[model samples]
Target: MKYDQIDRKLFIKNRKNFMAQMKPSSLAVFNSNDIYPVSADSTMPFQQHRDIYYLSGVDQEESILVLFPDCPKENHREILFLKETNDHIAVWEGEKLTKEAAFETSGVKTVYWLKDMEKVMFELMTQCDTVYINTNEHYRANVETETREDRYTKWLKQKYPAHAVAKSNPILQRLRSVKDPIEIDLMQKACNITEKGFRRLLDFVKPGVWEYEIEAELMHEFLRNRSKGFAYTPIIAAGNNANVLHYVVNNQQCKDGDLILLDVGAEYANYSSDMTRTIPVGGRFSKRQKEVYNAVNHVKKEASKLLVPGTDWAEYHKEVGAMMTSELLSLKLLDKADVQNEDKDWPAYKKYFMHGTSHNIGLDTHDYGILTEPMQENMVFTVEPGIYIPEEKFGVRLEDDLVIQKSGEPFNLMGNIPIEVDEIEDIMNS
Candidate 1:
């Protein structure tokens, strides 16, 4: 791992919180993600399953975390099984985690090799009456590929047909949504790295630069600062390309007078930071562009303030939609007649702003949080509101990551990044 060693207390606290919620005599198992194949003799880079990594700080593949809080044997209470490290693996793929190192990283004293998993699991299943299986249950999840966790779940179920089965996702979703102070610090580090990348573009961006060139500059900055790279696939959409949400083919040349919508952020220690900033290509926003930019910025600012504790997610979006509708009406994009005739499901503002105003952001880009539940303190969300004017051949979006506070306004993690028209223009021109 390029990042520094995180304090083990974070994982210890996470495990305690999770175990506190488990039903008595229930055991939960979490598996690390597989190294997916690209082709023969090649594979995609490994990404640790966030749930396991959250509970245990083990960031390696072929690892499993088990929580048997009520087990008869105290050693089996919290166990970590790893793909045992040796000198051969040390030379071939660098050293994997040793038993002593795993204990330090995860705070779990009991460790075993993968070879002993079946025997150890057999003993565990006999003691626990219920098994908790981790599944991809995030609201935005659309997984099709079979995972290591899936295979293990299948084997466990087939072997123990009499045991009661339960889901771990619901428990994790609620727990992972609220940020730990250490996790918040890590996310703040990611946002700081992203700020460095965005600031680099202020001077580097000018007319005639390819969109990919801007992406490259951000990558360079992120890499040098110890970030693994983008938290998610970056959208370096330039000009009309910005009208296409999720545009990633950054091939177009940024022409003079056009705006570049940079939806990019760096990842630190597997935590994510999502930000979107629309900047002028030639160091100045045109009059019309500035109007749209300011409108989007206004919505972003107001929308973020509603991310306080006790705010309902659905109601928050509705309020932001109303604010955006008024802005669109003033911009002449929507007439009063358009508002009256609009579909209830899709309002007049939908013509300009088609996506949701905000979502939970953290370990995953779209982090875990129940939309039906009211907001809670320490929950992080991204406030991204945009106006995509395809007919006008441009788009404007302003976004920032914020933490829901207890009483007042949310704390903006990306607050240091330039956002106001004057600040951006001055920096670009300077």
Candidate 2:
């Protein structure tokens, strides 16, 4: 891992909270993600499963965390199984975590080699009546490939048919949605790195620059700031490309007067910070472009204020929709007739602002949070509102990551980034 070690107290508290919610005599298991292969002798980068990382702070592959809080022995209550490392393995694949290192990384004291997993698990199964299984149950989840957890679940269910099975995702979704103070600090670090990237782009962007070049600049800044890189696939959409919500083909040239909608963020120590800012390619926004940009910014600012405690995510979105309606009307994009004839399900503002105003942001860009539940303090969300005009060949999106507060307005994590049109123009031209 390139990042510094996280405080073990965070994981200790997380485990305590999780075990408190588990059924008595129940054991929960979490597995590291597989190192996916691209082709022969080629593999995608290893990314630890968020749940496992959240529970154990074990960032390495081929690892397992077993929590048997009611075990017969105190040492067996929390166990970590890691891949055994030798000199040969270290030479070939850098250094893997040793037993002592695993203990330091995770607060778990009992560490076993991967080869002993079956023997250890058999002993654990005999002591527990119920088993908690981790599964992908995120609201936007559409998994096609069977994960390591999936295979383990199948094997465990067939082997221990009599044991009662429970899902861990629901508990995790609720727990992970609310950020701890340590986690909030990590996310703020990521946001700080993203600010560096955005400032770098402000100086690097100019007419005739390729979109990929801008992407490169951001990556350079993130790497220098100890971030792994973008939290998700970055969107360096320039000109009409910004109208396409998920545009990622950053191969186009940024022409003069065109706006580049940059939807990007940095990930630090597995925490995510999402941000979006639209800036002019030629260092100055045209009169029409500035008008649309300010309208989107206004919506973003107003929408952020509504993210306080007790706000329902669904109803909050409806309120944001109403706010967007007035802005669109002010922009002359929606008329009184269009507003009157619009469907409630698909409001008139959908033509200009289609996506949801905010989504929970933390470990994942679109992190875990129950939408129907009321918002709570320490929950982070991205307030993004945009106006896409294909007819004008440009689009404007302004987003900021915010933490819901106990009092007053939510706190903006990306507040330091240049957002005002005059500030952006001044910096770029300077």
Candidate 3:
């Protein structure tokens, strides 16, 4: 891993919390993500399953975490199964985690090789009446690929048909939604890395630079600071391209007076930080450009303030829409009559300021928090508000990662990064 080792205590605490919610005599299983293949002798990079990493801090392939808190054998209460490593395998591939190293990394004293998994699982299955299987249940998840976890789940269910099955995703969704102090710290580090990337672009961005060049500059800054590139596929939209929310074909040369909407972030230790900033290509916002920029900035700030504890996710968005509506009216993007005659489901402001104002941001760019539940302290979200004016050939968006506090307003993770018009102008010119 390019990132530094995370303290195992965080994983230990996460397991304890997850176990506390499990039914008695229930066991939970988490499998590492598969090292997917691209072509013969080629494979995509191995990314650890967030659940396994969250529970065991084990960042490797072909690993499993078994939590049977009320097991007959004390050592079996928490066990880690890892792929065994030998000198020959070590020479071919990099050295895999040894039993001793696994123990040190996961704080689980009992470790068994992957070859012994079936035998060990048989013993564990007999002691537990219920089995909790981890599944992808995030709101934004649209997975079609059969994951390693899916294969394991199928095998486990077929083998133990008599056992009561339960879903682990619900518990994880609630637990992972609220950030632990350690997690918040890691996310802050990611945001700090993203800030470095954004600042680097301030001076590098010129009228004629290609959008992909800016992407390369950000990648360089993030890698040097221990980040593993973008948290998600970056959106380097220039000019009217920004109107397309998911524009990523960053091949165009930024023209003078056009605005570049950089919806990018850095990932540190698998934690994500999401940010979006639209800057003038020539380092100076035109009068009309500044007006739209300030309007979006105002909506972003106000929307962030509404991310405090007790806020409802759905209602919070409605409030943000109202805030954006007022701003659009001021900018003449939406007329008073347009709002009154607008559809209740799709408000008039959506024409200029589409997309949700905020979403849970953490390990995933669109992290897992139950939208039906009220907001909680320590929950991190991205406050992004934008005004896409295709007619004017420009778009303005400002986003920041924020942590909802116990009291008062949420904390902005990108507070140090320049956002004010004057600050951005000065940095780009300096």
Considering every candidate listed, which one attains the maximal lDDT? 1
Per-residue error at 130 for model 3, in Å? Answer: 0.5
Clash list (residue pairs), candidate 3: none
**Residue 1 deviation, candidate 2, in Å?**
1.4
Backbone atom clashes (below 3 Å) for every candidate:
0, 0, 0
After superposing candidate 3, which stretches have Cα over 4 Å from the reference? none
Question: Candidate 1 lDDT, tens digit per residue, 165-217?
Answer: 99999999999999999999999999999999999999999999999999999
Q: Predict model 2's lDDT versus the native.
A: 0.93
List candidate 2 stretches off by more than 4 Å: none
Candidate 1 residue spans exceeding 4 A from truth:
none
- The models' CA-based lDDT, in order, is 0.95, 0.93, 0.93
Q: Which 10-residue window of candidate 3 scores lowest in summed lDDT?
A: 356-365
lDDT of 2 at 12: 92
* Tens digits of lDDT, candidate 3, 33-106: 99999998899988889999988889899999999999999999999999999999899998999999998888
TM-score of every candidate relative to the true structure: 0.99, 0.99, 0.99
lDDT of 2 by residue, 1-430 (tens): 7678999989999999999999999999999999999999899999999999999899989999999889999999999999999999999999999999988888899999999999999999998999999999998999999999999999999999999999999999999999999999999999999999999999899999999999999999999989999999999999999999999989999999889999999999999989999999999999999999999888888898998999987888888889889988988999999999999889999988888888998888899999889999999999999999999999999999999999999989899999999999999999
